[model samples]
Target: MLRRLALTAVVSLATLSAVTPAATAATGPVPLPLPLPVLQDDARARLTITVSGSEDSAAEGTFELRCAPAGGSHPVAERACDRLDELAGEDEDPFAPVPEDALCTLQFGGPATARITGTWEGRHIDTVFSRTNGCEISRWNNLIPVLPNVR
Candidate 1:
């Protein structure tokens, strides 16, 4: 009986060793792909700026901005690219949404509008900007470096 009990214990230990690894592996965290930054041949963006309404003078023009060896028609390519990078680093989407409950004055900063369409950090970006209210005005101001001289 002693020898039989010893053999049973050994068999049980072997079975446990064989099953433990498979069970642990089945419940382990899944291997997922890392979020990698996009690579591009060139970092370039075409921008359009337009201002409307009588409160502010009207201005409109189109220009290009480039970075990673910053050189483009944009008056401040380096500054603009730096600002863009800062904003992009904050979140996956650079154009962050305005908070709904945030308090803002009713003051109008004119009907300024901006349109950007190009590649950023190897990703295609097509976004619009408008200053119809306080929040929009703040957003437009934040992007002033890249935008045309609409002010």
Candidate 2:
């Protein structure tokens, strides 16, 4: 009985080892998780800035801005791209709007308005900016060449 038990145990072990490799092979190799920066490398930033209500025809026209290999109709593409990269490195969202509950000075900058639509850091952006009030004006200025310096 002792010999029979040892033989059964040996057979069971062999069977388990043989099935393990087959099961693993059937499932295929496991994929490694990509690093955060590696995943972010695929993200692209492309935007279209359209300004209106400004007397300057230069500032009123639509312009394209592409980063991560900057090339577009924007007057200062390199500077704009650098600014965006700086913002990204600082963990800031360049297209973020002013908070509604925040208090702002009651001052009208001008009628100059801009609409920025496209993708940034692989995220879709469709936001409007205007120099209507202090908050809005500040928001518009923050983007500088990205939105055209209408101030």
Candidate 3:
């Protein structure tokens, strides 16, 4: 009788071991595909802007704008989208550096900095903006609608 009980215990242990992995595998979460872009043509972009300046000024915000619809969290979404459309129309790169020989004032616009990362016209964009110099300041101001709160 003892031998028979031991045999039953061994069979139960074997059954549990065989079923455990299959049950765990079946219960595991299934992988899902990443969501598609909001716009098919890539005319939309989601931007996160962080603003910081001299000892006193600091702000941050985010925007998700689509040119065709002209919408997003930006305070001036329409204007921002228009500005971006203009850049695309002119075949100009907003993130391009200012001319090396261009003259600028010796003024200081503070140490404000901005980082823009998103998709533009089907292209991935990652750029930084700052008021450290004349060119950078121009770049920062040119993108005003998108960085509205940065003064």
Scored by CA lDDT, what does every candidate get? 0.63, 0.80, 0.66
Per-residue error (Å), model 1, residue 120: 1.4
Best by TM-score: 2
Find the candidate with the highest lDDT and give its number.
2
Locate the minimum summed-lDDT window of 10 residues in model 3: 33-42
lDDT of 2: 0.80
Order the numbered candidates by TM-score, best leading: 2, 3, 1
lDDT of 2 by residue, 44-127 (tens): 668998899986788888999889788789999989888887777776676888888979989988899889999987789999
Give the residue spans of candidate 2 off by over 4 A. Answer: 1-43
Put down candidate 1 lDDT per residue, 24-134, tens digits, no spaces. 688974444354334325444433333333243324556677777777776677888787778767764655556689887787766567677777766666777776678
> Of models 2 and 3, which has the larger TM-score?
2
Score candidate 3 by TM-score against the native: 0.59
Q: Is candidate 1 or candidate 2 better by TM-score?
A: 2
As a TM-score, model 1 comes out at 0.55
Off by over 4 Å in 1: 1-40, 44-59, 96-104, 148-151
Report the candidate with higher lDDT, 1 versus 2. 2
lDDT of 1: 0.63
